[model samples]
Target: MADRLLDAMARSASRLYGGEAVSELEHALQCAELARAAGADEELQLACLLHDVGRYAVDPSLVFDTGEPSRAGPHARGHHEVGAELLAPWVPERVAWCVRAHADAKRYLCATEPDYFARLSAASRHTLRLQGGVMTAVEVARLAVHPWLPDALALRRWDDGAKVVGKATRPLSAWAPLIRRCFDR
Candidate 1:
């Protein structure tokens, strides 16, 4: 399973993350680096690494064909949901939850922090509107109580910061042990 996940990521090494400056693999590696630097536990670091796997797991025709997700096509599952479900069988439940909630974490931040929206990159800003924009008060209240909210929010911050064009980060091969541990768990 770890090899499967790593292979999928390896396949994405050349694919740019929509309009982001890095490839999808690069973005994932960078996010994992951020999590590791922040001293996040292995599960949280794993969550950061695979949070966007849904974008790769889904039918390519249905996802990011254009700069934005296609609204006209068959109801495409959100990448977050897809990613979380994909990893749920191998990783801890909290790791899956963090993967699922990272997008909502962005909405939470945008709603709760005024300047947060402005910090988004152009592609992210475009997707934010499609992703439901700021959270409603009710939505905010619900997410606030989720046990994995902090991890999700932390992953979101790393996600946002991982778009550096040429940043050096550990290669995907270095993560095999961590991925294997999660799978073995």
Candidate 2:
């Protein structure tokens, strides 16, 4: 299962989301690197690495090829939920929860932090509106106590910073052992 999952990531590595300087794999590797640099636990690192797997899982034709704001429909299965669901069988619940909530964490941060929204990349900012825009006060109150909120928020920070063009990082294969370990348990 781990091999198959990693293989899928490898196959989709070159497919780029419009406007992003980095490919999906690059973003994933960078996010994972950020987590590791911050001394995050293995599960958190894995969560960061796999948070966007759902984008690859879905039909590529359905994904927006342009930088335009993505609309709801096929894209709404949400890379977050899809990735979490894919990893749920093998990973810790905390890891799955982090993957699932990362998108909402973005929305949460955009609402609660004054400068956060402005810091978002153009693609991210566009997706934000499509992702239900800023959270309502009620939504904020509910997410405040979520068990995985902090990790999700942390992952979001890494996700945002991972889009550097031509940034160097370890290859995807380097992550296999960690991914296998998460699955092995």
Candidate 3:
């Protein structure tokens, strides 16, 4: 039998990430390997792999399952918000915050610092102006609310870096040996 952790990961994916081309298993596995190859620490590698596991609490519809870039237009559905809600129970609040904050890395820029202020996408800039809740001050407060905030930032960066396109994207099964190697260490 697969280990319980692996099993839980699989069930979470099946429950929340079905039908979308973004296979849950594959996405997590790729994130893990990306973190690992990039020399991230073990916890971060795990975070990379499981960050979206919270999606299990959201729709089982497969919408968050694609790598399509969010373009300027009608707001489509997103998993990070609901996924953040799902993950709050299982990991550090900062981890969940990372997932939520990642959905619109731009929103955080508007809510918080001035450094990234100018780089904002035109759509995200519009989102910021529209008012009151694309990403609220409360969420920003929570994002800064954890000691792991730095770690969460790192994990989010790692997550973004993992989203390569097409066949160049690696497979989950390909990482089983790597996971085993890490686990055995």
Candidate 4:
């Protein structure tokens, strides 16, 4: 399972991340590093590393409406939902929740934090529209009571900060053992 998961991540190593300066793998590594630096547990770190795995794991040919209310889009699942679903059988529920809610975390931040939208990168800004713009008051209320909300928000912070062009990060090899352990768990 770990090997398969790692391979999925490797396939995106050279792929640009939503027009961000960094490649998808780079963003993943950097996000994991940020989690580590913040003293997050292994589960959270792994969640950060594989948060965007859906982009590579799911069929790219699948098309969907980005503005759909269900967050499922029209014909396909959103990447966050896909990633969480893919990880659900391997990792803990908390990890999968973090993966699933990171986008909602972005939406949460945008709605609750004035000036947050302006700080987003251009690519993130564009994706934000596709991610349902901002949370409605009811949506915010729903997310606020989730037990895992704090971890998801932390993962979101790491995701937002992981887009440096040439930032040094631990290689995928360094994380292979950790990935295996998570899968084994």
Reference-based TM-score of each model: 0.92, 0.89, 0.49, 0.91
**The candidate that achieves the highest lDDT relative to the unseen native structure:** 4
RMSD values for the candidates in order, in angstroms, are: 2.1, 2.8, 7.7, 3.3
| Weakest 10 consecutive residues of candidate 4 by summed lDDT | 61-70
Model 4's lDDT to the true fold?
0.85
lDDT of 4 by residue, 92-118 (tens): 899999999988999999999999889
In TM-score terms, candidate 2 sits at 0.89
Q: Rank the candidates by lDDT, best first.
A: 4, 1, 2, 3
How many residue pairs clash (N, CA or C atoms closer than 3 angstroms) in each of the candidate models, in the order given?
0, 0, 0, 0
**Per-residue CA lDDT of candidate 3, range 129-153, in tens?**
4323345878787656666666666
Please report, in order, the local distance difference test score of every candidate based on alpha carbons: 0.85, 0.82, 0.53, 0.85
1 versus 3: better lDDT goes to: 1
Better of 2 and 4 by TM-score: 4
* Cand. 3 Cα-lDDT: 0.53
User: Which candidate, 1 or 2, has the higher lDDT?
Assistant: 1
Question: What is candidate 1's CA lDDT for residue 112?
Answer: 93
Q: Give the per-residue lDDT of model 2 (tens digit) for 60-96.
A: 4343422322443554455677677888898889988
User: Number of clashing pairs, model 2?
Assistant: 0
